[model samples]
Target: MATGWAGDNAVQDQIDATVEDAVKRARSQLNQGPSLTHCEECAAPIPTARRQAVPGVRLCVGCQEVRDQQAAFSGYNRRGSKDSQLR
Candidate 1:
């Protein structure tokens, strides 16, 4: 059932789009070749366990944590409406 002005499949379409976007984003993050032995950011040695776990890991644990924190703060509300934008 359509809940809004779009159509009967609008909600399902949105859901499918969201899932597709997430899958694309995740696939983009995968390493293409060999894992780096050192952290690219801090030049620290990446642990063997991490390299084995992540496959093509770049940054060490500490640098990766910092990068993750920075990313967390940079996110935006992608679903914001035009009405909300005006406010």
Candidate 2:
């Protein structure tokens, strides 16, 4: 557990901070105020149940499904790889 210059829990601290940052970022992306009545992407009518359930629902079910498919990994470093951090 000898981490030389770094504390024993430094690695865990960094991981926790990364998770916290990701959560804050995700929450910040949530829409506030009134939910849109129509899908912003395809101009389709967003259902009342969906709107009530999602709070700030913007996209209709179909468009949202497509978007969810296109989305990719968005998280902290994993599999023991660093990206431009130790340069």
lDDT of each: 0.85, 0.87
For residues 1-87, could you state the per-residue lDDT of candidate 2 as single tens digits? 765698789899999999999999999998788889989999999989999999988899999888888785556455555754454
Q: List ranges where model 1 is wrong by over 4 Å.
A: 1-7, 75-87
Task: Please give the lDDT score for candidate 1.
Answer: 0.85
Q: For residue 68, what is the lDDT in candidate 2?
A: 82
- What's each prediction's clash count? 1, 0
- Candidate 2 TM-score, C-alpha based: 0.71
Residues 9-83, candidate 1: write the lDDT tens digits: 979999999999999998998777788998889898988998999977888999989888987884465557987
- RMSD (Cα, Å) for all candidates, in order, is 4.5, 5.8
Candidate 1 contains a number of clashing pairs equal to 1
Candidate 2, poorest ten consecutive residues by summed lDDT: 78-87
